[model samples]
Each structure stands twice: as C-alpha cells, then as structure tokens.
Target chain A: MNAQADLNTTVPVELIDEFLKRIPYVSEGITNVRLLDGAQRVMFDLRPGFENQRDLVASRISEIADKLCLNYRPGSSRVLVKREALPGSYRQDPHAELQQRGDIIAFGRGRYGFGPKLVRLIEFFEQRSREMAASFQADPYNFPALIGADVLDTCRYLKNFPASLNLVSHLREDHSVLQEFSQSVRWDGEQLAYDRNGASGVECLLSPSVCFHWYRWLRDVELKEPRAITALGKCFRYESSNLTGLERLWDFTMREIVFVGPAEYVLASRDRLVDLSARFLDELGMAYEISTATDPFFVDSYAVQAAYQQGFELKFELLAPLPYSGKKLAVGSINYHQDFFGRSFAIQAAGAPAHTGCLGFGYERLALAFLAQHGLDQKQWPAALDAAITASAAHDKA
Target chain B: MTSSPNESIEQRIAGAVMRALKIADPGSSTPLRMGSTPGWDSMGHMMVVMELEKEFNTRFPPYLLPQLVDVEAIAKTLRKPA
Candidate 1:
C-alpha cells in the first residue's frame, strides 16, 4: 500500500477511527486521539503503559495513514485535543470611557492596548505574583501566550471548554491555492466560506490559562517536595455573551502561582494561598467576598464531579462588583485540580500521580475594579494602593 | 420485590428522589424537573439514579443519566415493562 493512490484520502476523523481500532490495545493503550485536519495534527490520550510510547504509536499511525494516501505528515501528530470553533471575527472597538481616560486603547471588543496607568497596575500585579511565589521559593517564568493546540487537547481543554476557545490561523501563503479555494465558496453577503479549506490547520491557540503552559512545561518531572512556580502571560478566552470590560474579556493578562506535589501539600498550599489572597485584597481595601463557584468545566459527563466540587466548595472566588456593569465579579480564584493535571501530563509525585493547585488573578479586571471603585484618579486611591502606584510610577520615571 | 401497590412505589421513589437531592417539602407535587430543580444538580441526579436502582433492585443505563430528569421521568422509567 502506497500513499500515491491520490492526494485525497479519507476524512481525518474516519481515517483516525479506522486506525484507532488497529492499535495494539485500543481501549487500554489509547485514551483518545482527536484528529484536527485528519493529517496535520491530533491529540492522543495515552493509557498507563504507553505513556512513554507516544512516538511509536504516532509513527505507526502516520505510516499506515501514508500508505493509505491520506497525506499524512510524518511526525506531525501532537498530543492535544481541540475541535472546530465558532467563527469569531468581530469589529467592535473598546469601551469609550477607557479610551478617553487613556487607560487602554480599544483594538476590538475584549482586546485592549494598555496605557501607562494600566501598565503600571499590571506590573504591580506581576510584582505581587513574584512576592507570592518567592515566599515559597518558587521559580519565576514567562511563558508564551500562544500554546500548541495539541497541548490544549492533551489537557482535555478541548473536551471541557471548547465553547470559549479561539483558534489562531493564517492565510495560505500560496496565492493560487488560496484564490481557487476562496472562489469556490460564494459570499452571498451573509455566508462565509470560513471553510478552512484554504487556511492552515490551526497550529497554535491563544492560551486560556497560565497554568496550562506551566503544567505542560512541568510534564513528567519528578518532584519530592512541593514545587512552586510563578508565571505571567497574556491569556485569551472568547467571551460570548459575557464579553464586557475587564469583568469578562477576550484578551487579558494573568499571573498565577502554581504548586505541584503530593496531595496533602498541594491542598495545604492552596488553603494558604487562599489566605494569602484574602490578606492581599484586604490590604488593597478591595471589598470582596470569598464564595464557592458553581459553574466548572469538569466536562459534561462529569456533572456529578462538578456538583461535588460545588457541594464541597473546592472552588472559591473573590467576588467584587464590576463597576461599569454593576455585576458582581470573581476577581480571583483558588483551585485544587487534585491530580487532574498530573494524569494528563504523566507527572508523578512520590511514585503516584501528583496533585496540583493554582491561584489565578485577573490583573486587568483588578485594575478596572480599582478604577471603578476608586474613581479613575490615582490621587483618591486608597492610601496603601495609592502609595504603591506612586512608587511604581516614580521608579519608572527615574 | 412486590410493593403494597403502584401508588406506594411511586410515592416511595418520589420521596427518595427528593430526599437524595436535599430538596425539602417532598410532599409538594412540584413535578421535579431536571436542570431546574433547586438541588437536582448533576450530582443529585446521579444520587437519585443510584437510589432508584437500589430501591427497585434495577440498574439504569449510563446514557439515561440525562433522561432521568424529573420524578415523573424516573417513575415512568421504573414502570416500564421489564
């Protein structure tokens, strides 16, 4: 069997299913493999024994797929999962007040270009993140905002939060190929070919969480003691109906303090982190309440787990009022993933799956909350926050 | 398992569902609706299913998890011809 039968093979999904049944141990050896474009990329679910054998299975699938003439790109199979997303091309600009105040320039709805005050506020949050991590001897890292789509899939992100994902694509470089593909689909004013036939299979996704990058980086690393890492990055999440000021956004900055270790340590660290957040918010004089979150992306089938988390209050959020929207907001959250990340990445702690926890701060939302509550002027800001901002500004000037 | 009558079984299942979901006033004939019931969340739904299985000595398939929405829906499934 040679791949020369023709350029077109089977649709990636069908080809994947066909090959899935042929794997040595389909049920136990493989958890899942979601084909992106049938050939370009796919996320694999590795069972226990095959954790280190991703290359072998991927190569075999590609080899068989190539012989079947499916245009298999050797070594292109990636360990991730994602699905086709809704067409997300919007042209709305930023909120007017933010633009006038020079706090941010509107690039699009949910996308912003920060001004000096906002930048300094973000820096303030970043510094706070460092301090929070330094207290535990955590190493600092700055990971790219864009992550491999396969990586997201491997983390089961595609299964849980598919609705909120934004896939990044680029125009086909070959002009003639693109011209032909585009002309084939008619734009009757309302319909768009967004047919992806002319576009590249998405190579990367704007990360929705900072912890994903850190976990992916820490994949398969042995940790004896509780290890902490602080990371800063721009995270993007498509807010369908929830799109509004910093309250809910499309592109925003996030600073996270992640801990991975034995179950007791991770859970204990998360409790301490919650206390740390409470202290920090109190210091800033931000009026907020810590409440358990009901809505979690534990995937649809695990409604029981979602309810359990809610019932036990495993997810806590620091809620504040969104100034412009007048809606209560969750400015911070402390979560215990409890070996979910470890299972996804094959990471082990003390010869068993590691437990993980993270604290996420919505930096931009915090800034907006501050402005909303304190009236955009730094002069009237709370004494402690005001002094810090002043020092940040003076240090920058110096 | 023979019950005193059909009404007794119906009442028992309904009361059990209500209790498992942690909803008060099991006597209220509100027609427990899934996704809308105050405590009939996903977890509660699973508990209701398990309790129903044990009470009747019958197992419900996994796919029917979403289908067993209300007390009526569950009662109907239980009454189906075995």
Candidate 2:
C-alpha cells in the first residue's frame, strides 16, 4: 500500500534542501520523501507495511524541524575550480551499462560484486591515489574492516553519527550458547531467526572511514616529526533509504591519506593535496568542483554541527557532475580535524597535541562519475587513464 | 558557590565551564583546555557553550564555536560586542 502525507509544519526555505535529504531517514517507514507547496510543506511516501506509522514519522520530522536552527543561511558554496566537459562528451547511464556488460553484479541494495572492468577501474583510481600519496612520502598501511567501538566512542563518532553505525557481534563464547545458536539458527525468507540471548555484546563496529584507524594506531604516542599514512579500506555507513546505485553505498572503498604533526605541517599538507588533486582531476579531463561541505551529523545535532563545520570551513568536497540527473556526486573530501583527534588520542607533536587532516577519495563514486561523464567505452576515456588501464591489464597477464 | 554579579567575564566563563563539566573550580590561574580538562570532550564543549550562552544572554555565532575551546577563548568571545 502506498501512502503520502503532507507535513503540517512550515520548514524554513533556507533549510528545505537539507530537510528533504533527512526526511527519508526519519523512519524505516519513510521510503521516499519530497518537498511541496514551494518548500513550505513536505510529502512522505510510506512503505507498504508502514502506512500506519505515518503519524509517528511526522512527529519525528517535526521534532527535528523544530530544533533546526534558523540562524544558518546556506553558505555561498565556494567553487575553487570548475571544469567544462571535454568536447564530444556526453553522459551515459553507467549503472545500466556496467550491469549489462557484467562489470558489476548487485548482491543487494547498496552492495555490488565487481567484475574485471569495474575492478580494473577501482584499481586504477587506487594507483592514482597511491602516486599522490607517494609524492608526500606517505607510507602505505592496511587497516581492518572492524574497529573497536570504544575507539569510536573516544572519537565522538558515536555521538555525531549514531545513525550510520553498524555494530558487529558474535555468538557468546560459551558451549551452551554456541550449541543453542547453531541448533536454532535458521534462515527465513526475510532474515535469520536465531537465539538473540546467545549473542555476545558488541565490541566492534564496521569502520565508518579508513582514517580513524590511523589515529587509533598513534594513540598516546609523541611524534618528533610529522608523518603521513595512506590506506585503502572498506568503510560502512547505514545510509537507510538514501542508499542507491554506486553513488551511495552501505559499504564503499575509501582511499585516504592522513597527515599528523604540528598544526602548520598538517594544514600545509592538506592544502598541498587539495591543489594536487584538482590538477589530477583536470588531467583526467573530468569536469568537477571543489567546494565547502559539512558532514551529515544526526538530525538532532545537525543544525549546530553543520553550522560549526561550515563556519570554520573544516571540510571541502570534490563534486563531479552526474549529467543524466543534473546532480553532483561528492567523489572526494579534504578534512581538517585540527587538534580534535590529536587531543582525543593523546598524540602530541611540537610540545602540543598534534593537528591532523586527511583526504579521502570514494573509489566507486569516482569510477561511476568517470564512466557517466566519458561514457563506458574504454577507447573514449582520457589518454592517460586509458593508457594506465591498458598497462594495468598487461600487468595482470604477466 | 553561585556566580555573583561581581564576577569578571573570565570568572563567569570559568564558572560556566566548571558547571558544564561538573568539576570543582581549579582557581582562576589554572587554564582549562577542551581535551586536557576532565569531561571536556566534544559533547562537553557543546555543554560549555550552552552554559555560557545562557549566562551571557547571547547566541554565539557559529564561526566562533570552534575557537571557544578554553575559558579564555570563551571569555574573549563573550566580551566582544554582540
């Protein structure tokens, strides 16, 4: 059953876009939401079984809407560089092409199994990132997919992004519990039915981003000099109904380079990469923009955190245009954490808590943007990327 | 002790910080930075901001939020003309 309800409360015009973005995640029932009546009201589309919960969803929306600070005016987005599409460039539906060519298989919503072509493209992006990291003398590191929940607590991620957390659990380490779990567990069409009491308490979570592990690794250490580390890892965020296509995934690859040391060193390192990445994108002949951005803090803290992040200009994202939809996707971000991580983890440098920053590139989103802009035909790609892919293919055969 | 009208902006800010963090006053000379101080984590920092805002009867501009990491910084921001 499909149902729609118009929000009675008025949302400020300035916050309408953000308001729309957050509504779908208000509840499991809200499968889709949109603005109406000149952004004065909202319309929510309920999932079949959730039509009865519309009132509860509306109340939650109202609660969040009331707390949203009206003081924030959307900051004039600063476009550091804007590139025009290459001649004869046209947008193609990359998702369909990738599916048709068996380049990707959908395991579930927001999950995919990459075939040779997609895998090669992902590696190509990673190699480019590795080269960028190499220029900064960044040592490559690998991090586990799971992180201690305590580490996230210390990092304040639990408070800010509770909505996105994916906790991990295992069966309790007792003979009786294990026997019960093994005996009772059965897969129904929708989900597994198992003994809930047999499960152990959650101690770890699927890491939300790769850079957090670096901070956890350096905790309580004093740095005599600045250091840079790069890693490519799987990061998870439960984006609720917002999970769609390659653009928004529940689990995605993040290639991150993190710098830690004195404030000046870290800031300068972040600036250098921002410049380098812009040039790299230009070389790939991609039309993109680097603009100020804010994290999607949970709705309760959204207003304050968004304002603070934007006010200080702590984050900037590289947004590539999706031509078919006339929308832009953020393929990368440059973030300055100041002393937040340094202080939280007690990592010191130059007689003070170290400052830290990182640049994260979303590999799948980058590949999708490239395909959408340049078309799926490898021959039509920029010369450098095409050559690199060719060399990579040759390397695999050898 | 409750903050008296005679308290300086620095003292008032310190009081707010102390109240938000739920710690006793460490005297006027001792510095309190966000991470170093007990219970002054990110959430605590926001609490301190709220306390100061209530005490000063002003809403801090968002740009000023990051700079209010210590009592001195909070005092400095509060002293500025609204």
Candidate 3:
C-alpha cells in the first residue's frame, strides 16, 4: 500500500483485541468516550493492578483528563473514591486551599487547576501502590506503609537515580552505543557548588522516587532475587529559554526499573523492554531514537564516594524529535545499573553480589511527544493512532 | 542534600526570612519586608512560618508568630552558630 493510504489505515481493532487477550485476567476498565474540541479521551477505572482491590478508577480518569486537557466540570463526574476521609493531612496553602475535603486537586498549573482530576491523579498513585503490592503478592499492611511513607514527597525530576553501577559497567564494556555517545559533567566549583545549608543557596534535587524504589525493593525481595518496576514523577533542571509546552519542564515523570539477575537474562530483558516501549510509541504514532546514557562517574568515580553524584548525567535519553520545539525530549530510557544499587543495598545471591539494571520511561514526555506528532486537531489525526488510543480505552473496559 | 547544620544560622534562615520579609531575594543582602517580596504578603506569612519550621525541624510558639517580622529577628530565633 502507498504511504498516504498507509497513514489513513484504520488500525484493526483486532490488533488491540489480540494485545489485551494475551495478558492474563485483565479486563477492560474504560467508562465513557468523549471529545472536547479536538481532544479525544476515554474515562477508565484506574484499578490498582495489585490484589488489594484498591479502587483508583477516578485517578485513572484524571490521567486521561490531563493528557487530553479535559476540563471535567464538577457534578458531571462522580468518583467512587472520597478525599477528606484520606488519612493524611495536607499543608494548607491559603491561596490554594481546597475548600471541600472530598475535592481532588487537579492541574498544579492552569485555570481548571486542582479539582477532581487532581484528586483522581492522587487516586491513581494510590492505585499504583496497590498494583505494586499485587506484583509481589504481599500482604495488605506491608503495602500502605511502604507506599504512603514518601507519598507526599512525590515531585518531579530524579537526580542521581542510583542505578546498578556494576551492571552499567558491564554494559558499557559491551554496548557500542554506550561506549561512544556518552556525555559527562564535572563541577568546577564555579559551574556547580555545594549548597552549604541547602540553606545558603537554591538547589534543585532530582526526585527521590528512584532511591525510594530501591529502598522498597530491598525491603521486599530481601537480598536473594530482587526485582521491581517503579513509576516516579520526576523534575529535571531545564533552561527557562528552552521551556515550551511539555517539551521542557522544570519537572517531569520517569518510570524506572531495577532488576538483579544473571547478565545474559538481564541484557535480553533490556532489549525486550526497549522493543515493548517502541511498540507502545508506534501505537501512539510517534517516532523515537534510542541512545545510551553516559554517566562519567560510572567508571572513575568509584574510588571517591561523593564523586559519583558530583558528576552525574544521563547515559541514554530516548528522544522523540519534534517539529514545534525543533529538538527532542527524552521520552524513555533503558539503563543498565550494573551494581551500584546492589552493592549499596548489599543485595547478594549464593554468596556472590548480584548485578542490577534499570529501564525507564519518561511517561509525560512520551505523551507530549505523541501529541506533538499527531497534531492538535483530532479530525486530522491519523486513524491508526486514534484507533490505538480508542483501543487503549476499550482495553481498560475489558 | 548538601546542607550542614553548622553552616551559619543566617544561611539556614534565608529561605524562611525571605518568606517573612516576603522578599525572595533582596538582589543583594538588603533586608526585605513582608510586603516587598513577590507573592509574600500577609497571606504568605503562614507559609513562611511553616517553611521555617520544617527546615529548622522545630516549631515556634504560636504566640511568637507576631515576633517573626524581619530577617535579623528571624535569624535570632534560629539556633546560633551560623
């Protein structure tokens, strides 16, 4: 078929149907499908993927709301989840204090900011905790404490995403992409200096979610066979001049993984995740490039403990080139953290230290990039992309 | 993360002091007052107090709330040895 026809092709619903069929016991969780102007969205039950049966149906709905910029007029949407009864106390921002206890905060930015959509987002996070619980098949009490501890510390950007250094070391020695294209940073005391009190100067630290994820993994698997998939909302240092749309955010979201195992299996798994993530982007009709991340400290900084963080930068950034920004933002990344975390966490197996690796996706970046590719007008958007999104919604329902 | 408890109490109070003076930065070391800083008016003073409390990891007596007016005074309340 020609290119135009190919572009116009309606992705067969069968493909999405087939995709859902393969996953065990997952049912469609979507509610209603609506289009606001050119923005298309489908509300879905943001059910926790875990067995605790924690309902996040509303949280899932807000993610869609944010992605599509839906202004969910109150009284229009009903949440199965309640807010004021939430166990934790929120610091009151008098200027932005939410009046209603059950009200969910939405849009940390924008006119329709901080409402049910935001509430749903928090609900989504709550559900995610439940999902994590499901992954380990762990008990209920073990779940909330682990999830709630740093839940409030949730922010954007993750710095020093402590990875498996030994694994990355092994990968660098082997992978061509890593060996050549890695970037490094060095502090001259001029370029970067210590924040004496965190007190004296303004310092932005990356999200602690990755580190927290590591802490949680250690708690669960306990040194034998450790595995975890963590989704963390992250913020990064961005130039004010470079900021435009979601392409450049002082903050962003990053989903990273740390798995410790045999080298061969881990390498294969990394490739599989890359492929799976690519397929996900394809379904979104977005283009991407996979590049290796370069952390200069991965090699030399080992001798000095603090040197590693003093000079840290990403080894790889999966970028989706955009026309609007004339540049690409990292949408996803698959990093091989050979042993930094394993050694730090003292994870061992069979009396030998384990090798670890991580795969990450910048979920928000991916969504924004997809939006960039598809054009704002829903009518002009490719049918395949539309179909895939619809399928995502429908899949939720099933 | 790069903070030390011994680093001058003045440095520690910078963030909080800025909130009370309502000044984000005086541009130089010039002192800031409550109405001077962007977004720091009467309404923001509470947030400033909360921020100061969290950063110092200590709470001020509720009656002392009115006493926190300027940078120097806020500095006095901060534990010494800045």
Candidate with the greatest lDDT versus the true structure: 2
Chain A TM-score for candidate 2 is 0.94
Residues A1-398, candidate 3: write the lDDT tens digits: 00000111122231222112211122233312222222222222323443232233333333323322121111111111111111112222212233244232333221122334233333333443345434433233221112222321231112122221111011223344343333333377535333222222212233323534454355323455444444444434332223334444445555555456555545655666566555555544556666543331111122121111111211345677665545656775666544444444556644544556665565445644544555434344457544544555566669
Mind giving the per-residue lDDT tens digits that candidate 2 earns over A1-398?
44444554567775765676677667776765766776545566787788788778778776667666433434555677778664245766779878988998888879988887878888878878899999999999999999999999999899988888999999888999988888888988768899888888999999999999999999999998999999999999997777889989999999999999998998899789889899878877788989888888877777767766776678999999988788889999999987889989999999998999999999989888888888888898888888888898999999
Q: What's the distance in Å from true for residue B10, model 3?
A: 55
| Candidate 1 wrongly placed segments (more than 4 Å) | A1-97, A172-175, A178-195, A296-305, A323-326, B1-82
Task: Give model 3's docking category.
Answer: incorrect
TM-score of each prediction: 0.61, 0.87, 0.38
User: What are the lDDT scores of the predictions, listed in order?
Assistant: 0.66, 0.83, 0.41
Collision count for each candidate, in order: 5, 0, 45
Residue-level lDDT of model 1, residues A90-119, one tens digit each, is: 212324666787777766567678888878
The candidates score, on chain A by TM-score, as follows 0.69, 0.94, 0.43
Off by over 4 Å in 2: A1-9, A48-51, A70-74, A84-88, B1-61, B64-82
Clashing pairs in 1: A12-A38, A43-A80, A80-A150, A80-A154, A81-A153
TM-score of 1: 0.61
**Steric clash count of candidate 3:** 45
